[model samples]
Target chain A: MTGTAYVKKIRSGEARLWPSRRPPLTRLDIELTERCNNDCIHCSVNRPAGDREARAREWGAESWKKLLDEAAALGCLVVRLTGGEPLLRDDFGEIYIHARRLGLRVMIFTNAALMTPGLARLLKDMPPLEAVEVSVYGMKEHTYEAVTRTPGSFDAFRRGLGLLREHGVPFIVKGAVLPATRGEMDEFEAWAAGLPGAAGLPSYALLFDLRSRRDGRKNALISSLRTDADEFVRVSRRHGEEAVGEWRDFCARSGGGRGGRLFSCLPSGGSAAVDPYGRLQYCLGLRHPATVYDLAAGSLREAVTEFLPAVRDMRSAGPAYLERCGRCFLKGLCEQCPAKSWAEHGTLDTPVEYFCGIAHAQAVAAGLLEPGEKAWAVTDEAARTKRRR
Target chain B: MSDKIDLDRIYAPSEDIVVREIEGEIVIVPLVSGIGDMEDELFTLNETGRDIWNKIDGSRTVAAVIRELAEEYEAPAGLLEGDVAGLLEELLVRKMVVEKE
Candidate 1:
C-alpha cells in the first residue's frame, strides 16, 4: 500500500515531552571562540579574529563534541552557541550538527558578518530551534562601521542577513547603543520592525561591560562609550511605562534585603557557561580566577555537581558591599551581580558604581525610591512606602 | 498496494531523526526539513503509539511486532495488524522510519 493509505490512523503533534522531574542541567552556553571578524568598540570579550595564538588555544571540533555528549548525558536540552562571533570558527558546522544530533536545541549569537549561503542553507535544512540572534551595530553604513571598526562589515552584515532571509532561516537582530549608533536608534527600530518574524521592540545593549580579560585599554574605551545614568534613563524610556512597570514588579518581588550571600539570583545547578578554552564558569561574566573551573583538567559533571555549587554558596565579607548593596531593596532591580562586579572591579562582591547609579536611577523612575535617597539607607519600610506614595 | 501483512519484512527507525523519551512521552525530531510539518519542529506520540515505537527494533518483522503487541494488550490479531501497519506507513511517509534491507 502507498504511504498515504495509512496516514489517518497515526497521531502526531508538537507537544511537550519533557519528564516531570526537572533535569539537573538544562542549559549550557558554549563560547566557541573569543575571536571575532569585527572589532566592536563596546565588546568585552573579543580577540582578533585571526589571532593565531588564540586560535591555537581553542579546542577542536572533537573536544566540543565530547563536551556536548557529556552535557547531553547530564540532561542538557538547550545549548547556546555564542562568542565574540561564533561564525569565526571553521568547525562551527560540525559542532552544531553534533549538538543537534544529541537533540539539544541550539541558539546562536552572531554578528552575522560571517553568515554565508552554505551556513544559511544548513540552518534552513536543520533548524536551530531558537532563532539565530544577530547583533546590529547601526542601520547606516557609517554608523555601523564606526561601532564595528571593520571597514566593510556593514555590507557583510547586510549580506549575511540577506543570506539568512534568502534561505528562510529564522533569525533576529539586536543593537548596541553607543555614541556612534545613538543617532540611528529611530532608524534601527523602524528597520527592525519591518523584518520578518520581528517580535516586540528590538533590544539594545545599554550597559556595556568592561573587558573580561581585564584589558585596561579596552576597558577605558568601553567605559567611554557607556551612557551615563541620565542618558540610560532617557534611552530606556523609549519603552515607556512598560519598562517602569517591569521594574516595579521586580522590586515588589526581589526588593527587600540580601544578607551576606552573593549568589541569591543563581539557580541551584541548572545552567553553566563554557568559555573558548573549555573553562567552565557559573555565569558568563564571572571570570574571577577563583571561580573559573578548568574543564580540561576535570569533567563537566565535576564542575556542575561539585565546583559550581561551592562557588554559588560563596558569601561576601567586603564592608563596602555590606554597607551598600547587601541591605539595598533595589537588589532585585539592580544589575550589581557578582559577574558584573567581577567584570568591572576584578572582585566578585565589590559593587560597580556605574551599575549602582543605573539601578538607583531606575528605582527613582519607578517611584520605588526618592531622588538622592539611597535604597540601602532606607531603614523604615513604612517611611519608605510613605515616600513612594 | 498489498492488503496482506509482510510477516518477514523488518522495519527500523531512520538515521535522520532523534528519538527521545522525555517526561514519559516519545518525541521524534527530524534532522532534515523539520519534523512532520509541525511548526514547532517536534513530533510526539501517545502511550499506545510509544508502545508500538518501542517494538520497532530493526531485527523484528512487522508480523513479530504485531504478535508481541497483541500479547501485551487485550486486542485481536487483525486489529493489531491494522494498527501497526497504519502507524508504520504514516511514519514511512514522514521518513521517520525505514524498511530494513
Candidate 2:
C-alpha cells in the first residue's frame, strides 16, 4: 500500500502484527507530570503560561497508582518517569516504589536539580532503580542557565549529581546542543564521561529543534549553538567508532536516550506510552484523540493487540501521512514522530522541517548525504557503516 | 570462572535434558538476510530441554536437577551431573535462561 494509505489503515484500525501475539516487553513511556520547573526552550509538555494551575489540579497520587498497576500487568519491564520534572511531584518516590515492587525497572529522566542526598539514599536501596539520566544544559553557568533560564541551576544540578555519586546510585548525564553550548561540546562530553559510572558511556547531544517546543519560534541561542556538521563528524571520529555508533543509534530510535527504533518504536508495535492522565498513545511524539485510551477501564493486552494497533494503522499508515515520513531513509534516524507531527501539521503524520534540518545535519556529518543534497542519502558510506551487519 | 555461576553475568536454563525429553526443541532463526534487522530471535524448548531447564530454573539447588536427571535417564549419575552442569553454563552464556538465588 502507498505510505499515506498505510498510515491511515494503521491509524484507523489495522492491528499491529507483532504485539498482537504477545504482550510487549516494554510499555510505551508514561508522562508522570506536566509540571516542570525549567521552562526549556524545546519542551512540548511544559504547561502553557495560563494553564499551570489547571494542570496541577488535574493529576495526583491516586491517578498514578491506577496507571502503574495496569502497566505492570502489561509486562512492561521498564518504565521511564518523565515530567515538566518528575521530581516536582511529591509522590514520585511512591510511584517509583509501586512500579519497582511490580518488577519493573525504573529510569528517571530529570534535570537533576531536584536530586537530594536523602533521595539518593532511598534510591540506592532500591535494586530496580536502574539509571538516572540528568540533562546538562551547558558546561558553564551562563551557558547552562541561558537555556534553563534559571540562575544557579547549574550549581544545583552539579550538587545533585554529586549526591547521587556519593550514594552510589547509577546515573548518566546528557546535554543539549544549542548555539549557546555548541562551543562547549567537547568539554561537556568530557564532563559526562567523567561521571562515576560513565565509563563506556557515550554522552550525546540532542539537537535543538523547533518541533520539540511546539512553536515555530527558534531561539537565538539555538541558532548560535548549531554545530558545524564537519566539526561534529571530526570530533565524533576522534572519540572512536563506538561513541559515534551510540550517537547514531540514539538518532535512529528515541533522541531521548531510550533504545530507539532498533528496539520497537511506532511502526514496530512493541511499545505503548500512557500520559499522566492515563491516555494511551503510540509514541511520546504523537498524542491523538482516537489513539488515546483510559487505562482505568480496559485490558492492556486487549488494548495493545486490538485498539492500539487499529489507531496506529488508521492514523499513521496512509500515504498522505507517509509522503512526509514513511519513505525517508532518515525516518529511523529522525526523531520527528507524532509529537512532531502535531507540532507541524496539527496531525500525527505530517513532517516538520526543523527535524529535517537536524537529521540533515547529522546525515551530512555522518556522510549519509551529499554536501548540498536535501533528501536523505541512505546508501552513503556512513549509512553503510551504521547498518553494519 | 569457577563452576559457581554469577547471576548477573550468567543466564542458564534451570534444568537438564535426557533422550526422552528431546521430544521438542527450539532454535533461534537468525534473520541475517541483510543488515539493520537485529531483534529478539528465540525458539521453543523441547520436553527434554524443558526438564533440564526446570532443574536449572535457579530456585532449585544444583544437586536437585542433577538427582532428577540422573533418576530419569538411568545413566551413570556422576557423569550425567557434570554434563548437565556444563550444558547449563552454556545456556547461561547464551542468555537463553537466567539465574536467581
Candidate 3:
C-alpha cells in the first residue's frame, strides 16, 4: 500500500524524487521478442518469425508484470518496449497496461505493420504513452516490400499508420536507409514531418551493424549496401553544422572517457537493456554472457545490485582498446564501442574499421582532423589527451 | 584547513542542473555540460550532503544553514560549519552550486 501510494504520487508529479531525494534506475529497455515478420536484407538481429521455439522461449505477460513491479520498486520511471516487432506478442496489451499501472511512462518501438485497430484503441484509451516510435522502410509499396521482403507489408504498414491516426494516438516515424528506400529517403522524411506527431525530421541509421549475438551468420548483401564513411559524413555535413557544433560543445565539457571500457557513459551507471530471453545487458547490443545477467534465474534485485555492477567493472580485453579507443578524445565523433566491436569482429576489443573510417571522415568534414588523417593512428600529443580515470 | 567561508553570501543550486532522487541518494546532473556534451559523469550526494542540499534554497546563508543543521542533528555547530563549507567549495568547483547575486 505504501509503495502503491508512492507510485501514485510519482505519476501525479507529487513525489518524483526517491526518499533520499534521488532517483533509482529511470529506464528499462525490453526487447519483447526477436521474431520479426519483415526480412530486411540488412537486418541485424531478427530471428525468422517462423521460429516457434524462439517465441516459446520469451518470458510471458505475468512474468513481465512482476518485473515491472520490481522495477517500480527500484524507482524506474520509464520502460521502452522494443523488438523486431513488439506487437507480435498477444499479451502486449496486458503488459502495456501493467507498466502503466506501475506508473511507468512506456515508450514503444515497432515496425508498425503489426499495429492493429484493437491495439490502437487500447493505446488511445490508456493514458497517453511517452512515445511510440514507428519504423518506416519506404515511401511506396514496392520499395517498402523490397526492404521488408514481405509482399503485403506495405499495405499493413499503411493500415497500421491509419489506425494510429484514426485513434489520434501520438507516434513518431523513423526510417532505415536501405538500397530499396535510398531514393525516397528525403520524401520519407518530408512525409514523416507532416505526420500526426512527428517533431522534426526522421532520424536514420546509415551503417547497418552486424548481429550482436556473434552467432557466426553473415549477410554480405547488406554489407554491400552500406553507406560508406565518406558518404555518411557528406550527407551529415549537408544537413547542417549543428551536429558537429554540438559534438564540439560536448567534448569541451568532458574531455573524453577513460579509454578502456565502452559502456562507461550510461546514466548514473545504471541504464540497462533486457532481451527476449530475460537476459539483462549493459546496453542493447552488449550480449556477452559475462556481462549479460539472466533475470529468469535470479531476481531484479540481484541483477541490479550485484550483476550490473560486476559487468560495469569488467575491463577492456585487447591492446587496441587500451591504446587507441581509451586515449582517443573522438568518442563524441566516433561510433567505437564494445557492442559495435563485438558485432563486427566477434570480440569485444577488436576495432571496427567502418566506425574508425566514419569517425575520421566526419572529423575531416567537421574540420576536427586533416583530410588524410587516420583516426586510429592519431599520435598528435596535443590531440590525444590521456583519458581521465 | 583553518580558513574561513564568507557567511554573508546567499547560495543555491545551479540553474542548469537536474536534481534526481535515486536509491536513497541525491544525484545532480550538470545539464549544459555532460548532457549536451554527451559526457557520462553524474554527481551523487551522500546523506549529510543531501541534508545540506535540502537547506540550500537560495534564501539561506552558509552560517544559518550550518547552525540549523547542527540544531536539528544535535551536533557541534563548528564541525557542521566546516563540513558545510567544504561541501559548498566542492559544489562550486563542480559548478553544481552558485553564489547568488
Best by DockQ: 1
Indicate the TM-score of model 2.
0.66
* lDDT string, candidate 2, A78-103, tens digits: 57888668887778778877766554
- Off-target runs (Cα >4 Å) in candidate 1 are A1-20, A379-389, B1-11, B22-27, B37-40, B43-49, B58-67, B73-95, B98-101
Ranking 2 against 3 by TM-score, winner: 3
**By the DockQ metric, which is better: model 1 or model 2?**
1
Residues A1-389, model 1: lDDT tens digits: 11223322212221134445655577899999999999999999998998999899998999999999999877777799999799999999999999999987788999898998889988999888778899999988999998889999999999999999999887889988999888888888999999989988889899998887889999999999899999888888886777877777777777577877898776764789999989999878889999999999999989998999999899899999898888988877788888988878889899899999998999888887779999888887444544454
Q: Between candidates 2 and 3, which one is better according to lDDT?
A: 3
lDDT (Cα, tens digit) per residue for candidate 2, span B5-85? 432342434222111111132322211111112121223343454556555554565666666777777766565554555
Query: Model 2: C-alpha RMSD to truth?
Result: 11.6
Chain B TM-score per candidate, please: 0.86, 0.52, 0.86
Prediction-by-prediction clash tally: 2, 50, 9
DockQ of each: 0.31, 0.05, 0.05
Binned by DockQ into CAPRI classes (incorrect, acceptable, medium, high), candidate 1 is: acceptable
Candidate whose lDDT is highest: 1
lDDT leaderboard ranking: 1, 3, 2
Calculate model 1's interface RMSD in Å: 6.5
